[model samples]
Target: MKKTIYLIIIVMIILSWNIAYGEDLNLSGESYVLIDAETGRVLYERNAHKKMPMASTTKIMTALVALENGKLDDKIAAKGECIGVEGSSIYLREGEVLSLKDMLYGLMLRSGNDSSVAIANYIGGSLEGFVSLMNKKAQSIGAINTNFANPHGLHDDSHYSTAYDLALITKEAFSYEEFGNIVKSKSYTADREENNYFYNKNKTLWEYNGGDGVKTGYTMRSGRCLVSSATRNGMHLIAVSLNASNWFNDNYKLLDYGFNNYNRQFVYDSNQFIKKIYVLNGNKEYLNLVTENSLFYPFKEGERENIKLSIDVPDTIEAPIEKGDKIGYIYTYLDGKLIHEGSLIAKSTIKRINKFESIINKFKFK
Candidate 1:
């Protein structure tokens, strides 16, 4: 009986340890990173800051800028510069016209260099003007290490971005509804006068489950560059790979590792009851408090218990308090280090005592 109990206890300890740490993946890429889309938490990364040419993946920003600022229905005349510029093309004929939306699909799905130049000229009024917009957007989105020389990711000594910076750019782009629709599409049928059809160049969209977005790029200098996003179990993940030969395989590996190992656990649901806060000189002596928003943090399985939750409240607050008044905060910590925090708010209003009560107290008090 003693031996059996000891064995059970030992087994439990081992199981607990296993839950706290996830398996490490052998990701194949020159530089790569995986991040939580919602929290911007880095799940895994390797040499993510090494600047390298990104090839046509540069079109992601081009598509994003045009979608956000340019009118979709506006007809843009294809210029001479849009024809036979370099790299890939959707075969935009000189003097042909395409809607802003069609140009986007062509720019993204087909990696059309011609579409990029035409859109840039139409939206920015010049290629130089549009490149400035791309750089500005990159800076605004915390992509500090990125620079763009052209709307398309052509090989230029100065055209470069890091894996991490590209990940940040991809996240910013995903916030737009139309950007999401375009990147995730497998194919696009353009309503051009010539009738155009373009299929997505990002193969992970069809090959991997839950695979949605992003872009792919290739150049002799850039090698193979790819950014991809996926959703699983209510969690969204973005991955970037630069100068990698096995870009698609690496994305799959990183995503599977992220989805299987990490999970977002809600520490406190919105309006969940916490503790009653004392209210001095009010109709009620105390008011119940609760968290204002859902509080969540990522934790590996059995590590949930390691998260310490604490509440801070004043001794007592004067009344006439509103229902949503903040009285305290509940904070979560890991090994005494801060992890996440949420506001503790009053659940109900506490009105001040009547004037008659104040007068009676003043007369009766010794």
Candidate 2:
């Protein structure tokens, strides 16, 4: 009995160790998180819930609220108030005029403080109003740990965000085509009235493959900060790092882990045959249902065997169905737990049966 108890204790220790360090993870940062943009699922994390100074990443939220509330094509006149706002500038001259779109390019790509203020003033009539909008937008998007004291992300003691909240905000920003386009740009030239041009300040665009536009920051108090995004194959991952000693290396390492260990595979393609379902009193006895878009899943290496696919389809769907109508659902499972779901849509319309055929079908059912 003594020997058996000793062996059981040894086994429990081994099991606990395996559970604690089994994910092939190595990371260093005060707060960090990698997330899938499409699904908003956290792939890896370290201290992700701890709120810290986010530095220039605050511009992401500023840009988002500005774009959502203000028109892109509207002209913005650079006022004296925008001058000397401090830290990263597109060098806007007083009284200079540019479209809101050009200024955003300047703001996001160049990380321009002046442009940030210009946008804030143009959209909200004052910086305080714009900051209020930023905070409101953050709350609405589930960024519970975020607060915006200024539009440019200047280091204010009150301004802070958690890794998880930054990821959430970025995922929301990615939904805007304008935001996505601006961030991915490696270089953008903003022309002033006299043919003066300013180039983008983000250096990662030139350094990494699929390194689209995001933001980077460094302050005496905030250390080095970066919000980077990349797409390879069909997978797009967003990485947020705050107060890291090595921003670039940490981001690259996190991105490499994501791409190397996980895969985005198409479980189902649009208009492809999922299965056939029976139809009642319809012109066609059977109808084909398929996905409208390719369903992508991120699976760990060698873990595909653990994944399962299941389809939930209704029997005898009613007639007069419209094409592309949702008819069923396809679920992807891991270890018998559903991880993802895609809609199964009708491949083509199913018309109602003629009166004679309907009568015959009714009699057959009886």
Candidate 3:
């Protein structure tokens, strides 16, 4: 369940399309969006939430499910589910067994539709089961507009996602070190099959600076769908373009806008003041609260006004409070929604007072 955090945006002209203050970017996709990989902020968007065909980009989530659920060394056999799927393939035959690592490389690098079925069947026990995991993962990641009817992202009227949803999915995929490493590789070789080789389809890896792992997709119905990620000067960005005539260029422009125009701004430093908590039945009546880590986020020019910080700490806590106790939270919001948060911890320990100590404290005070 998503809880709303109200933020007062002074600019009202771009509310409906999910646009924050950023450089004016012209893209060639029917639907496209840019987001902060760490913060999930929609730095720029056009028809972001409007659902459309995402084609092979659906494999991003498929790869994510595989990495999260299946062991890399787990041996998966090519079965009936993998036979003659549409689009691209690694040409796996029944009775052939390959490591999950090889299949993942094939799925992302070659966009192997057949490998998708093999993984879905082996890890999920069946195609339907894998599809269930896909949908559940989507919901878990707050991608409400996404639905995965197939693991390989072969076009189905029911299998569709918005640009915003795809970006969210890609960002989540990048969080996994294995997924991130796989997407960025220019080439991958099958560990079991010496002759098998796969090359990354995301052209941005070579054409764009700081290019990392991501996925590219296409179908006649979906046109060209591409999800691209990049890191530059400590800022990571995810760019999604759906039905694009020129996806590589569009993604390049999107990333450039994010890296060149915005920066990661620190709202709270580690050990920063949060609030004073009242203590009951303790040696001290109040305790200072602070954050354990610094909170930093990407923001565009003139967009700092959209960011708001709030501290929600209990008015009073019980005795025996210890240092580093998480008694509250420090939240950061953008456009009236929470973008980041951290625990509010006690700055110092406080001990409880026994009956004898209380009696002695009375005389000492006098």
Candidate 4:
């Protein structure tokens, strides 16, 4: 009995260790998440759902809101109310005229609070109105654990975001090439005029290889928060660290883990032939259905063959089909679980076959 009890305790200890650190390698932060930008899959996470003060990372959402709602080339006049908001600044003075694009550069790369307020005022008519827009956008993007009290990420209790939510928001932000370009720029010179030059403050663009420009933030109340993105070998990843003891180390470690462990594989390429379906009474005897967009998945080296492709197309299609019409779907599976799903669209239009033509073909073939 004593021997059996000892053996049971040893087994329990091993099981507990495996349960705690089975899939993940190492993680150190109050909250952290590593997500594949292509699929939005949470590769690694710790305390991701816990809401915490998000410091300057909040500006990512600010930049996104401004980019979508405001025009880039439109000139924005610095209102007297936006002059001295506080925190990080682009050193804007009253009556300063700058393009919306330049301000966004400052807002994202420099983490300027004044730029946030100015954008909020310009796009939403007031900071309050802009906060409303921000909340709405957050909800639309499925950022449920996020709230916006200010355009700038000050240490208000009301202004907080979870690591998972930050990853989700940044993933959406990356979809806009304009936004992605601005954030990824290591160093850019923004001209307020012929004389004034504003430089980006994000040092990661210069410090790290393949480092894209992203916002960094710190406050006594918020501790240290950083949202960083990097692209390697055609795979993009977003890493969020909230209240981290060492922001640079944590960000680098998490980003490296994602890049090293995972690779973006084309599960389904656009216009690639997925399946062929017979057409009944149509001009074309058969129709080729293909994927509309390239489906991507994060996979390790030996896991390629384990990925299964299941094409769920209709066996027979009807006539009068327009080109590019969605007919069915392709689902990708890993270990019998669906990982990615894409639509199968008609490759070419199929007009109805004339009754005489159908009869003649059937008789001739017979």
Highest TM-score scorer: 4
Better of 3 and 4 by TM-score: 4
Name the runs in model 4 displaced over 4 angstroms: 1-27, 193-195, 364-366
lDDT, candidate 2, 5-103, per-residue tens: 999999988877643432234445677888888877677777788978887888889889888998889999999999887888888889999999999
**Local error of candidate 2 at 64, Å?**
2.9
lDDT for predicted candidate 3 compared with the true structure? 0.87
Residue-level lDDT of model 3, residues 202-223, one tens digit each, is 8989999999969999999999
Clashing pairs in 1: none
Q: TM-score of every model? A: 0.76, 0.82, 0.87, 0.90
TM-score of 3: 0.87
The TM-score of candidate 1 is 0.76
lDDT of each: 0.86, 0.83, 0.87, 0.83
Q: Which stretches of candidate 1 lie over 4 Å from their true place?
A: 1-24, 270-296, 308-366
Tens digits of per-residue lDDT, candidate 1, 91-177, equal: 998889889989999988989999999999998999999999999999988889999999998889999999898888888888888
Q: After superposition, how far is residue 49 of candidate 2 from its true place, in Å?
A: 1.9
Worst 10-residue stretch by lDDT in candidate 3?
1-10
Model 3 spans with C-alpha error above 4 angstroms: 1-24, 283-285, 305-308, 333-339, 348-353, 358-366
Q: For model 1, what is the alpha-carbon lDDT of residue 140?
A: 89
After superposition, the stretches of candidate 2 with alpha carbons farther than 4 Å from their true spots are 1-28, 69-71, 124-129, 132-141, 156-158, 193-196, 353-357, 361-366
